[model samples]
Target: SSLTPRPTGGISPIALPVLESLFTGNLQEARKLVFSQMLVSGQAAENGGSNNFIIGKRNQRALQVLSKSVDQDNCKTNALLYGGMHCKDLHRRLESMGYVAKKTEWRTAWSVD
Candidate 1:
């Protein structure tokens, strides 16, 4: 099915339910929800609609969390794994925060011919 733009549903559908599960200490349920919603989100990005906008919002939220971890938690090291499409924007954001890439490695999750 071609993904239809549901402007009202950028990420909340997945995030909220997954978050709820996590908050309830249901790690297994949260994991399941993430995979299930990932499929839907992947379809949407592959097929249609404002994918960039959605991805941008997700990246922004992720960075906010990362920032808190660094600033408030005094984290000396952290790892962020996100879709490759988000790298450019994330790199810019990290650089703006005076972060420089120390190393980069690519491990193929899958590839299709």
Candidate 2:
């Protein structure tokens, strides 16, 4: 493929794998990004919260299914797709994590760098 970038505008949680690697090099930045993502999860992940994350604004069941979509490939199709459409709540989670989003003819893509 060409060297052209993905038009990620800014950092995105979608690049979790990259961030994880970056952590070894720049621990501060990596921690910041990861912490931001945790906050964005809306789970707060405080001392004693629900400790559950929702997908597609549905229920815990959706989170269960979405987890399946987050395998090695990290394909979010099933997580974002609800009633044959994109899920706002799920997308918001990305936004809250400071991930830049881009809308294309095919689908909404996010990236972080």
> Could you say which candidate leads in lDDT?
1
Candidate lDDT (C-alpha), each: 0.76, 0.50
What is candidate 1's lDDT per residue for 5-95, written digit by digit as tens?
3687654544766776777898988887778678667766754357777877888899999999999999998888897677777888889
What TM-score fits each model? 0.53, 0.24
Worst 10 residues of 1 by lDDT: 1-10
Candidate of highest TM-score? 1
Show the lowest summed lDDT stretch of 10 residues, model 2: 46-55
Error of 1 at 16 (Å): 43
Report the lDDT of model 1 for residue 21: 74
Every model's Cα RMSD, please? 13.8, 17.2
- Residue range 1-113, candidate 2, lDDT tens digits: 11223577645535554465575687767766676576556433332333223233363455556566676559856434443122445556556656457772454343335
What value of lDDT does candidate 1 attain over all alpha carbons?
A: 0.76
Per-structure clash totals for the candidates: 0, 2
Off by over 4 Å in 2: 1-13, 16-24, 43-113
